[model samples]
Target: MRQGGIVGPFPSARERLGNGAISQSANDWEHRYRRTVIMSDTVATALVVGGIGNFFGARDAANWHEKWGILAFCTELLVLGALAVSRSWAPAVLGQGADEFRRLGRALFTATVVLALGGIALTSRNIKLWIFVAIPAIALVTMTARYLLRLRLHRQRKAGQCLRPVLAAGSPATVRDLINRTRKFPHLGWRVDAVCTTDGLGLDEDQLDGVPVVGRLADVAGHVRRDGYRVVAVTSDPYWSPHRLQRLAWNLEGSDAEMIVAPVLMEVAGPRLHVDAVLGIPLLRVSMPTFTGGRRAIKGVVDWMGAAILLLLFAPLMVSVALLVLMDSRGGAFYRQRRVGKKGREFTILKFRTMAAGAHGARGELAGRNEGAGLLFKLRRDPRVTRVGAVLRRYSIDELPQLFNVLTGSMSLVGPRPPLPEESAAYGPDIRRRLLVKPGLTGLWQISGRSDLPWEEAVRLDLRYVEDWSLALDAVILWKTLRAVLHGQGAY
Candidate 1:
């Protein structure tokens, strides 16, 4: 079963160790852990299918024969079984990133395809009605259930529950960085319980980055067995050659501990990464950044259409905001500031004016009191903002006028933040990448802490969005923007 010291292909400890007692304990715990996720999904699927079936069955008694009802029940069970086989309830992805949602979507698509083929084989016209009802009902109900479960997982993690104990193995610096990141985002659910260094370098100090140093790299396997650590995370370290990692992975196998290697690549989204096997070597492949194509064209159309619809819906509110702006200050209802747009095109960004008529002129005098990131200027209690302006800025009501700019193609519904001319002038070559696409009314920065982000973080997010533009990602950002505005976490 061994291939150059790599762990066997099977994930089960019993297959590797042949120790009935130890493997049985691991299996039981894993079973119980997986049960919660599986049961939740199972209940959601049953409710959606049963509810839809009963409703439609009552509506048309002639169509809902006993045989047809039995067929519907069997079809629902088959789809549920398919979802289970796809590992939609896998514990590794349950409370984590977008993988859970992605898996759910893939499973649903598979179910649809299977049902379509089955309907064709059976020559049944009623299957069309079932497909239409089941797809939306299953998708809505299952996604809602998973989101609620994720919220519970996050709450539990905050209270220090449902986290796997991790033993970090690497150099002190990488281990420290990994530990800090784990602490900062506890919802990812890895708690660094101990550390093991290359040569026990920091063991004398007893701790590194708040995690206790237990042993040298050679003692990692012994520590896992002794302390019952569930995960061993190996980050970048000179001592961890391929052979060394393979040997480590082998030793940890069937010990109730899983080994995970964290690549040094940072902040790259999952969509951009793939693993390629070439000549028995595992290589990480990063896809080329996409900037132009059919999708981009579709995005442009969506931007214009969505902006027009929103403007129509919010016209009354926009008018109310304009009146408030005029009553609170002696300025025009609308303000236009020169901003750098796509490919360095300068545009006059529109907004309901939130400051006095001469506030721009007074910006120079308050430069010394600037509180914003990099070249940006901000103040918690600016003298320029009118009383009404504060409320608008807090809830982002002032930015509604930008829908016109979106319609005009000067901005997008979701993209990087539109920079001021001054900010763009100071941008380095790397930062200029943000100008690759049209600037946005809202973007990653808006949903991810907004004005509270540091200059470097804000720039990074903008560049990331520019490099990895997808309509799906845009939809996610727009959805999050609503939550962000409601919470008012970092708004001015």
Candidate 2:
């Protein structure tokens, strides 16, 4: 079936899109279904929470004696509806989506603000502020429920359900890179079965990782028309002039397929994007990294505060682990190892001993069995681990003692993981930059597959963290650390 270009409806690519009729219609039902589920979920949560609040207040509700329940129900619906209206939720439906969570949480907060403003307007200022507590609490519960739903959906997506088939359009290398990236993060749920490149360019998608190439740049619309591909990701290239690109963009208009342009700038983080349009000329501005001076001060304060609190809270557990270590083997409960730290300073990083006493004293015995990266000796199932140590290491309980290092300013709550002195000694110049900041109890390395990561990837993640340090980013890394710690997939 032939379809007009730019301003016309989309044609079907594969029969998989359904019976060869692929307008927005094929995607519409799923879209509407998702939005409806999200709306219903939020609306239901608002009603239930509001109803419970109203029910408990009905006893002393002399003001609510005249058909108050109905009024309250309507008021709750009004609040929820208003909050939903303020957000852009059409992109996702059901219990969860990333945007859905962001908006729903914000909307719940807005509802609280609205209630506070409404209370202020009516002079209901006596202990009435307690009503607002339900706002955050209910939002948390609702968002948590949505998170569970997202987890389920992600699992389903991983099993190959509910996905968009994409035609990656770029140079073979870029297309493969994009495919590899998207494949690595399957939560985005895109399945690329086709590839297309710029018209008659030397860059062919034929050799691009076995995905079939349908056509080239100028024939993109025609290719989509014939094959029924609904998404085309165009990598940035110099050949397409501004006008030609705009024409290409215009040509894909009103189709089921969406055009995504991937720019060449890889170092730009998502948070750094800003746009300005002066007389219709748009500018894309990138924010500079904010990891020095004042930001460093805030990071220091958080590191100290977090370490102090964690240490205080875990004192009894730490003591128990110490006793276990002393009972299991010999020597002290704590182990001190020289590690490379900030500015290449050598520090004795602390940990609850998870190895037999003098495990390294027998270093010559295990030198041939060095089961780790080039310099660092790590073993998945090391016989050196004491019985009690296995349990401690499994859940990362052994590292909790390192909080002391953090408190003494010898380490940080979130930064690059400290390297062993031997590991540091073998470093290329670039690897030494991992010592630019104090080491962390948990870091990008710990969160990103921990000991399972390749030496190169470990270095890459550390460098990335150093170049893009922020307190907010630190907080995120800490949060991810909790999840990683609990999962403990790669710790041992």
Candidate 3:
């Protein structure tokens, strides 16, 4: 839901099936789902308000409708207009990034502000109820609808449908990296149909990483037009000077292809990027990372409140798990181990014991069976795991007690995973960057692949989280974590 939105509607038969495919016939063949998505959102807002009113009482619903129908209609349109003004419907944002959700949030806030100003202008005092109910309902329902639609789009992309062919124009290394990354995450909907290099140095092989070399940089415009490529990505290539790139962009005018320049700064997130024009030249500006101040304080408050609430809601489940652990093994129900936390402090991390009382004593004997990375030790079929423990670990039920860690400020609900002391000792400089933030009960590594992730990849994801941390990113991770837990993909 964070990325990808309804591009317009489904393409016509000629665009999809016939020889006159949109790729072949039109240069402006980007997904045009803004109209459909926006219209449906508006309708959804109206329906939700009406449905809420009817749910309260039919007579009341009718009475309210009669009294406020026109005003309500205007309000809905205003919200939609705010979204459009925010460029939430821009083609580039479709099906990509937290910016879409961020813009949606801005639109909702603008709606609220607009309503407040309008009520003052009219000197009305009765609009409070309408504002309180309608705005939230509209935001929730519309966002939910958009999320569901995004899920559908992801399914289609996974099945290789709705993908726009891309012609990668860059050096061989960067081009291969882009292809690999796009292939790895097909939800991005970029299919490297062909590759175009700077000077066609590797054209003798006609391919790099299995993507055919269509042409050189000079031949990009022709290949894009002839082959109907929807994307022409120019990644960090020195050969394409700024003027040369500008000319290429001009050449692509009115064509179906959209030209994108992949800057060298790939690690930065959208929220941190801005464009500044100085004397007619556009420069990409990157903001410094925010790890302190008001936002961090807000994160701390959310972690404490969220942990307390989750503990209350899951009390019954936690008690049941505790009882099961005690009955299944002749040991304490709860386990505590010293783990490193934020600022390299030690904390007693808590969990539901899933092994025998003396399981730690057997570590030396089973060292030969270790299957983990670096200083870590993991065994898929470890002998020490009790019957109840196996079940607990599978869906991560054992980690439930970490809520206390989060509540006590030793952990966060979302951050990098905490490493053991020995593991911390083995860390190189890059890996040590993870210690800058409080470790989390769940994080990118948790939702991604958990124990199945390779050591290098896990460190990379953790560092990525460290660099681009945001509340929206955390929300996305938590949502994905729920799905991962339900599916139990990589849990041991």
Which numbered prediction scores highest in lDDT against the true structure? 3
Best by TM-score: 3
TM-scores across all candidates? 0.85, 0.78, 0.89
Give the runs in model 1 whose Cα sits over 4 Å from its true position: 1-34, 56-75, 120-123, 294-316, 468-472
Better of 2 and 3 by lDDT: 3
- Give the poorly placed runs of model 3, Cα more than 4 Å off: 1-36, 55-66, 201-204
Residue 453 Cα positional deviation in candidate 1, in Å, after optimal superposition: 1.5
- lDDT tens per residue, model 2, 1-492: 322211222232334455334434436434644664566566656666566556644435444322335434544664567556856355433423234554665676666666666656655532242345555556656655555655655665565544556777766667778878767866665667677676533344344565667767677777666555657788765556778768877877766677877768755443456787878976677677555688789888988898889888999989888998899987788889998888889989888888887788887787787767655678888888989899899899998988989999999988888888777888889788788888888888888898888877887888878766766467557756878888987877
Q: Work out how many backbone clashes candidate 1 has.
A: 0
- Better model by lDDT: candidate 1 vs candidate 3: 3
Ranking of all predicted structures according to TM-score, beginning with the best and ending with the worst:
3, 1, 2
Q: Model 1: clashing residue pairs? A: none
Query: By the TM-score metric, which is better: model 1 or model 2?
Result: 1
Enumerate residue pairs that collide in model 2: 12-228, 13-227, 13-228, 34-93, 35-93, 38-94, 199-217, 230-257
N/CA/C clash count, model 2:
8
The C-alpha stretches of model 2 lying farther than 4 A from their native spots are 1-33, 36-44, 51-114, 126-132, 199-207, 225-228, 236-238, 278-281, 292-316, 338-348, 361-368, 374-376, 404-413, 421-439, 465-483
